[model samples]
Target: MPIDLSLLDDDQRIAATAPRGPVCILAGAGTGKTRTITYRIAHLIDQGAVSPNKVLAVTFTQRAAGEMRDRLRAMGAVGVQACTFHAAAMRQLRYFWPQVAGDLPWRLLDNKFPLVARAARAAGLSTGKDMVRDLLGEIEWAKSSVIGADEYPQRVAEQRRTPPADADKVAAAYRLYEESKSSPDGMLLDFDDLLLHIAGALENAPAVAEEFRAQYHSFVVDEYQDVTPLQQRVLEGWLGQRDDLTVVGDANQTIYSFTGATPDYLLNFSRTYEHATVVKLQRDYRSTPQITELANTVIGKAVGRAAGTRLHLEGMRPAGPAPTYHSYDDEPTEAREVAAAIRGLIADGVPAREIAVLYRINAQSAALESALADAGIVYQVRGGEGFFHRPEIKEAIAALVRAARRDDLPEDPVAVARAAFAPLGLTRNVPEGAQARERWQTLSALVDLISDIVAGKEAASLVDVLRSLRQRAEAKQAPAVDGVTLASLHAAKGLEWDAVFLVGLVENTLPISYAVKAGTEEIEEERRLFYVGVTRAREHLHLSWALARQEGGRKSRSRSRFLDGIAPDLEVESSPQRLKRARTCRVCGTPLETPADKALARHQSCEPDYNEDAYLALKAWRLETAREAQRPAFMVFSDASLMAITEAMPATPAELLDVPGVGPMKVEAFGPGVLETLAPFRSG
Candidate 1:
């Protein structure tokens, strides 16, 4: 059936009118931006003005690419080249090599860590596995950013003067790595090199560039804000002076700067093309009005970042539940409360698969996961290996090493790891024993040793060595049952769930302490990450934080600053349910009859100064929580619960449960005590 696009408003109609040149859609959240852009592609094909192969669509993630392709296919498009900047580059490089770069034979390092570790050992880096792994990340980040040996000092930004492996040595190893790739039987082309080679293909050989230009004369990019410098450069090289670019993105959503992406590409697209069609979408299709209003309030504070990004939820259902802010007294309590919320949401109709519990660091999810289990909410982590232990890694590593040798390792190891280990377990080694521990420890040491070697230099027999390691690891593999996914926010990219619970919304995590604004480019990239997290939600979205943890530990944290970036109309907050600051009458120990409080407003003139204990209680709770435990409480239960109870005066345990947030568990726990403490019913 044809889509009732007539229902689409004017801006959408403009977006649908197959753009002739550069079309920039500065769409806000829920504005049907993706739908409009997808329809535009379908329409172009429908009009027979563009062949499927002639149109190239670029997205930031494989999932996004898949989604675009699926949408186009549904609308009758076939054979469109829809893929990530990296994927597209690789696809083109696969065939254009002989024509452009003289048939250079370079093997790709699909999983560079192991190979790098082997190389590190060959280069002689004596370190623990954890340290080696960290080092590999640094080296990979350097490579990804195109920071060469000569630019090491200027680019690394780390404090070490003499690197663990000296600059000379590291550079020497990188040269070896390059040589390994350039060699006939060598293997190792990192994703960074994909862009490099494509750039070379376009810049070095005019024929290759001309062929691509002739074949793909028009382009469409989704989530354009997340495009990297290399990607942008490649697109420019391919498109040359032609303008047939339709770019859609929201600048206010810029949150992925940590990965070297930028929203400026989308923000300044209009300026980049003089004859561009620019459109702004304010009709959000995701969140409810209550949610939108809170989201709007949060982002409204953003002072002049993006000109046209507006998150309007006026068109969605009036509201669902106002985003509740739950400030806990402690960490465990917070986790427990969050679990309960997940349970309640599930009971209220959210499927187990619909909910996601996200946090800043990988560590935070442990407690939340435990709490969710305790609550019996069937959950699967979005990231992290739930089962597969060292043995599992070795098997995958062995297979991967073998595949790389055969040029058969798929594009993503993470994907392969996921598929292979769906049946593995973490306790594959054995029950506790000194010998068992030693063998595991030795495997750990080897993994560490290999990582150190890989992060340093190139090595030989990498395939054979990994195969042996795999055999050793396989001897102790275990199979796992079902569980929620556990992942870092970075790993959670290009994914969505029915309900997303952003656990560590604290200041340092979502914006991430390491996320820095080195320049205008970096700052814009950071904003794009915020957009990524927000747009990932297909339905329910929960942002949580703790006021404190276990008594005397790290202080509980605040909500993610990204939450502050949302447009107020999005209503990202259910704050009355999360936070409360109520004045009380000293004479009667009753809440103040303030103008905002309907029931108490009549007695406003006679209200007395509230007891200071309430505020003290809040402060005391925040100070006494275990940072971890406190985090969950603040995530689920709000100060409003206590205040609402204190003011409403539920005289009995049953009546107590009648309060919106009160449940049977609370009645069995605090009901008797709270009911006994309500002095007298002093009517307002």
Candidate 2:
């Protein structure tokens, strides 16, 4: 079948049919880069310029490689090789290892943590899990950048890297790790080693390099912006001075610099191959105009090399709702209110699966998970285990169950639960380090669950509280297939949703403290990350931040500086403008003078006629209803709604619906109970 050029835009068509020496496609977010590249390969095959068997397509992930193969096959272009850099290198290494080393291929190291811990022990360094993980990360960075143990310290200084430990200690650990891997008894090869070994083999072994180079005549590399130095060396070996290559990437999406990946290769492609065909894909088909506009605005503020080459995405879709900005008093309030807004969207007919709540870090998911569960909304965590399935949470639950089985339980279930998690390092102050902080957040969420359970019950026993927890755990075990997605921004890349909530957009969290300290380049990467998060929304985009980490804590946090030009009318507590807009009475429009008036949003003289008995009765009913439903009391009815009910004394369902705060959904849910609560106080 002849390749159809009609399917592609003008730029895509030009890129697909361009002369095949060297081609570069700068694909922005939502651009049809994948389709363009696939069609380009098919077009080349159809034109008899390249054989399908000799074309190798390399991407960043197994999933992406699989998708590429599937698309090529669907387009009637089969026999093309599509795989990740490691996968491609591993195949060649496996074939040549017997000839080169006179032994079976080394067993691939599945988990590096154990090996890293052993290396740490050998080096006389800390063997804690966090330290081990950090050490492994540093080692991987060093190896992937093609820097050996001896050169690690110098490279760290040159790159301005903040090592997990002292530079000398990290170098020692890296040395030990390499020595252990190369020992006679220990034949282990990690993912990075696969590339390093192959690159070396091609450079040293002429027969192996000749055979590998002869196997492929053309190459297509996706996500070229993420190519690390080691991967680039491997690619060069495969090319063997040939320029038959096409690379596709977007510099704005280069968020993995810390992992040794760089956009320099993509940015400097033309410098290496002077005759390369360069094409830019800027038309975005994923999001609406409003979303793309915000995306452009966010990226427009970015500076530095990657940002200088950024593509300004042009949305092809119709206009959508403008992105919203929200400010909350505290983190818990932000989570709860965001959950409430999600529930409202679902009620408005948006599929739960079409929504997402993206945060800056993995630890931020705990509070959001609790809030969604309390709102009776189902959510699945991406790139990590579900809240209940987390190891720490499971351990806490097991401890609680064992304690409940004991006969010497305290009257306060909260006390029992707290004591159960105390051994797990549950404390008022959050611990330092990434792993410890995540553990603390998970345990803190469990404690908060206990408090909510006890608050809802009249006189809850340990057994009853444990049962409720067990029920909640069970519910969280198998989340609904179509549940809201809770993911960190990094995990949310390459995916989009109808409604996206970019929560926890405070300074220390989004740009992050480390990025702030790392200087301008890292800060620019964070800004690009923010741009990535903004583009994930197809229609509704909500960006929110909190004034404080916890309730009653100091309101010292500020919104991310990236939002300075994008979000309108952002008012922090300390802002003089915020102070100027004083609290006012709802009825009289007069500035409130006292704390009582501010709390009530009205002056005492402007207060409506009160009925204490009716108000108390309604409040009791709301509490009982919320307890039975296992929901927050505010979800059932806010205090303002209860006050409106008390003042109106609505006797019928229609009259109850007439209350300002009451809507059709509320009337359908609790109308009869509300009417009965106000029956005796009716004037009629």
Against the true structure, what is each candidate's TM-score? 0.63, 0.78
- What C-alpha lDDT, on a 0 to 100 scale, does residue 504 get in candidate 1? 55
lDDT of each: 0.59, 0.85
The total number of steric clashes, by the backbone 3 Å criterion, in model 2 comes to 0
lDDT of 1 at 438: 29
The residue ranges of model 2 lying beyond 4 angstroms of the native Cα positions read 395-471, 478-480, 570-684
Q: Name the lDDT value of residue 110 in candidate 2.
A: 89
State the lDDT at 412 in candidate 2. Answer: 70
Number of the top lDDT candidate: 2
